[model samples]
Target: MKEKKRILLSLFRKKSNMFLLGILFFLLFFMLVSVSIYNTSRDTISAIERTYGTSFSIGLTPDKNDMNQWEDRAIEGMDSPVRTYIGPNVDEAMVRRITEEVEGITDYEAGSRADVMLYEYELVPGYHAWSYNYFTTHEHHLPYDPEETKNMMYITYTYHTRNSCHFDQFYNGAFRLTQGRHITPDDAFKCIISENFAKRNHLKLGDTLKIDLHSLNVRAKYPIESLGSVETEIVGFFELTYQQTVTQYTEEIDILENWVITDNEAGRALDEIIGRPYYLSASQFFVENPAELDEVMEQVRQLDWIDWKYYELVKDDGLYSQAVKPLRTLKIIMAVCLVVIVTSGVLLLMLVILHSMKRRKREAGILMSLGITGKEIRKQFLGEHLALGLTAFFFALIVSLAVTPGIGNQIYGAVNKGGEQKVYTEKEIEAAIARGENSKVAEMSRNQRTGVEPPKELTTRVEVKTALLVFAMMLLIVYYSVNEAIKKTLKLEPIRVLSMIE
Candidate 1:
């Protein structure tokens, strides 16, 4: 034990050796942390891109009536004729039939909307005037409430609708429930609500709300008719980050809230109310590989039901590219930084070893004179440096692990502040259900909603394989540096080693 203590004391005595080892170790640790953080950031950004997908909107010029003849011609020319031109009034049955005939269609949802009134029960006791005002006036001014001034216990009303193409494309991808289940195919009359809407309305899951539809003669002060009353049970509520909430209102009509989400079943019901077909203005197609995108687009173009002039096939690859371009650029920068770090680490280690060799020359000569084998003397020197390198490496790794997460979070937050907060809501779904006026409101909501947020941060657990890899690298570097130091320090002529100076 005394001998071991002496050896250790001797090893650390050289300040240059200590510094060299620390630098190399720190470099490796920092590199590992940087790589890990960068990968995590890239993965997060990619996830956000995936959620948005490739979004493209289709606008028909002069409406579907103008393109009816063209659609008929395309369908008539097909080998197996199928109805291809889906307009704003297309029904669910038509969409289902088309899906059966299309080979490439994995899934689809039809978009439709109708103006419907949202009805909630207001129970105000005769004795509680304050409670009556609180429920009728204060709550009514909220965006979801249409009757803000009336004191007769008004239940705020808003519209709901569905955008068929948007629903089909983003159904499982972008829409996720924060508190409740999604509006499924079975939920024809059911609806989900946004967190904001639910909070404003004081609503919860399993609560039934009434919806009333308006007739075409909306201008008639009392022209709105309860064409059909549907009781929608609140199935889900989603949190809307500030980024997801729409801040601007461009249309002539004002919307209650900026966030909305819904399924196709509600859209179908609205279609029955309106005489025309409804199609989502936008569509998105996801491909397993980017290379296959062009082929998929080609297939969509050839479909008789699709109007190339009015609609366009969107590829997810473009969206992914746009989202990650900045990240990829950052990765390149990090790679350059890695190179600089490695170069500096190697140079610093080389200098320290060279200095040690120079300083230990006399000691080496005395050992040689005492008949110590040059190889054994060299082995001790190598061992000491290896020990120093290892010590520094471990210290650096500890520091890096603690620091990288914060650094990653800050970088992500700065670049993606606006994208992280917007969420979808059921009011938007209801707006989607209402065609014309309600449909316009839904579009306004989409436009005004907060920009999408960056993806959630990914936590990285250090893997055993990574630890092993780091260890191997450190060992290899230490071996090379120490071996080189040994050969230079020994400096003995093999033939003349017999002479003894001590």
Candidate 2:
């Protein structure tokens, strides 16, 4: 056994054989590393998609007709007919029906808004930048309440949802919770007031906020005249970052300072006061699997119970699609690269084995003539290639740890040259807000650029399982090539092999 092993080891001592081994080592190394990177990149992209890629929204799809599209009514003193787009209304029942029936929907946010008059507490004055200046320059009278002591009106937002983090103001960095926590679905009649408003009202966490429901305004058509008041416990305080507005309207109620966020029960109580049905102003849904978002949406559409006429299912996946466009392209490129590398590597390896076998044809014939079985001769060739392959595998794994990150990032950077929209993390947004960089956050939100940036650099490493998989595949190909080459060479008779070699 030792003598045979010595002969096998002696093959490596020859300069020519060493050169062949060197070539084989390099080929297998690149092949294994390439495979590892491809897999790692796939996993990274999937994680990004899962974290930031899936979002859906349910919105009103108003009737599209000449009469319903616009209400062309002339005011007694107006010069022209003012056209207004009257959208359809959404109800609590509809929100529940859609959410309950949608299979892939993992979570949703639903909320209502009501404008109310404050009788006891004074509201923080609304800051007007453009509108106030424009009215003053144009000598137009501002729309101030005739009675300064009269109750001030403000809008209150109410929510009952699994995740309140999806709120536009909170999500876009326009508002940050300064004290306490957000309103979750489990909460009932809890409130989150702005810091300025809380200070103005002399309120703190755990204080009760009493709002008069009778003072609710319905587009000035009529006052709510609701006979009751709803009181909510203030659980949170949020700081409203300064905002830059291009277009402005008159009214403190239009600003974020006067806005109050509360639970669904509080909102429902307001509706109950007026003896009116519960309605939802906004509802957002999310899916479990972003990759199958389209399929989930299709399932929602197929539900015959849903009247597509009154409702529209709007997908926020546009940004998701844009964000993942390059990722998807990178995935395809990786797949193609894997195919090309594997196919070429296998073919090249087969040729190398064949050439090496041809060189040792005389040796193989001599061994067979010495009563050595073809199986034993084939095993010797297998052992030689296996040794080289194993060495290359380990070396490739070690070196790949250093190179994969760079190569993976380069591939990602190349495909994402144009760059996707940048979405900030909660911490980054809060930091920007703290620095009074509200305009930056608002601009990002306004442009509908909600797609999160792909990973700055793809983190890739050759995992042990991945390395073993590639090594196993390499060994299989090497074994097949070596066995085939040996079979062809060993078929020749010992005399025939010697004669041909001579």
Candidate 3:
């Protein structure tokens, strides 16, 4: 311990030398570590922004509210094939045209439904269709108030759909399969019922329910296209996690309650018996990436098969943008700053260390003349810089901890106009929504597919991995500087270093 102190004191006998070295090492290490922290934090912030900020949805929506947008743009003279049939539902041939014409779609699922009565007193509701209880209370259920709707018959049909769908009515809280398994798109005869409806009807899995398609048309004096009772096999029942409430002016009847879900073939069988060749209430089309939704929507609109009268593209971009905008701005600014800091820090550190090389070599020679072994002298020189470098590293770490988050937030805040991001701003995108010319709105961004938002603030921290990396880098640099000086001292005689006094 005593010898170590003597060697250290000998090296720093001149207070001026010690003061200068301390300042130099502190400044260099601080710059290096601080810049490293900036770069690391910037990358972390960028990843968070992209992963959560790119959320959005693009699909063939049944937004009847938006129909006016396209209806106004319809050019009667133009030659086009797509068309609508009953309100929101599109033609089967039109859907086939879309499958063959459009590009940039990742996956798709189309679905349709019908209304039917399970018993004389009951008009069972499925999807968004009204049940006997709700319609019975409304005066308009009969165009003229019927004396009593208790015995009235209504139309209800089984539903059929494709797979991997993000159907708004079904994806809300999502349903749990309470009995049996899911109905695949291939099944033509199997069906699944709501747990509540199953319990109410005293029906269990494997039970066969007969749905009549011609009863309503026959009673209304309209020609029944086909007449017969179709028996559907109940394969499963699902319990609702959350049922979606329909928006006003929406013609959709499927809202997840008492809604029977089946595959397309079975649904078509029911539709054919009721006279329509094909009807798709709505179909959702997924894009490969949410970030490219606007581009994809535009390409879809320009296709020859698209006729706005029947189908419109639907977007849910507003749902998540307001949640992630601020963090996105922060990530952008921090990334730029990180680049500047790292580039400047490396050059400055190299120049300063090379300039001090001669002085370090002189110190090594003097220590060797004092009966000190080569290893001990080397250890002493390395120890001195380690202490100074580590102290500066800690100071840099503290500054990074104190400044990174505030700096990122401040940069983002300034760009966002004093921390108050406005309500979602609309951008004129390249593509038109089925509503014809529609502006894309930017909200607090979120992950569109997962519907999850990112952390509120820019994430910054001196992680253990980062700290160790900085320490290892500084140690390596210090060792290189010391080793170069020692090489020169070993080549020179010890007596030659003592002759500097003369």
lDDT against the true structure, each candidate: 0.52, 0.67, 0.54
The alpha-carbon lDDT assigned to residue 495 of candidate 2 equals 77
Residues 180-297, candidate 2, lDDT per residue (tens digit)? 9988888888888788888888999999987765442332323234356788899989885544231222245555666678877888888888676766877877788787788877
RMSD of 2: 7.5
Question: Which stretches in model 2 have alpha-carbon errors above 4 Å?
Answer: 1-7, 48-89, 99-107, 112-163, 166-178, 185-234, 238-281, 285-303, 309-326, 409-449
Model 1 superposed RMSD (Cα): 10.8
Q: Give each prediction's root-mean-square deviation over alpha carbons.
A: 10.8, 7.5, 11.6
Please report how far candidate 1 places residue 158 from its true position, in Å: 9.4
Candidate with top lDDT is 2
Instruction: Please state the error at residue 316 of candidate 3 in Å.
Output: 8.1
Residue 374 local lDDT, model 1 = 80
> Model 1: how far is 353 from its true place, Å?
2.7
Residue-wise C-alpha lDDT for candidate 1, range 367-391, written one tens digit per residue? 6666777876766676776677677
Error of 3 at 462 (Å): 7.4
Give me the displacement of residue 368 in model 1, in angstroms: 7.7
Number of clashing pairs, model 1?
A: 49
Q: How would the candidate models be sorted by TM-score, starting from the highest? A: 2, 1, 3
Cα-based TM-score, every candidate: 0.56, 0.68, 0.45
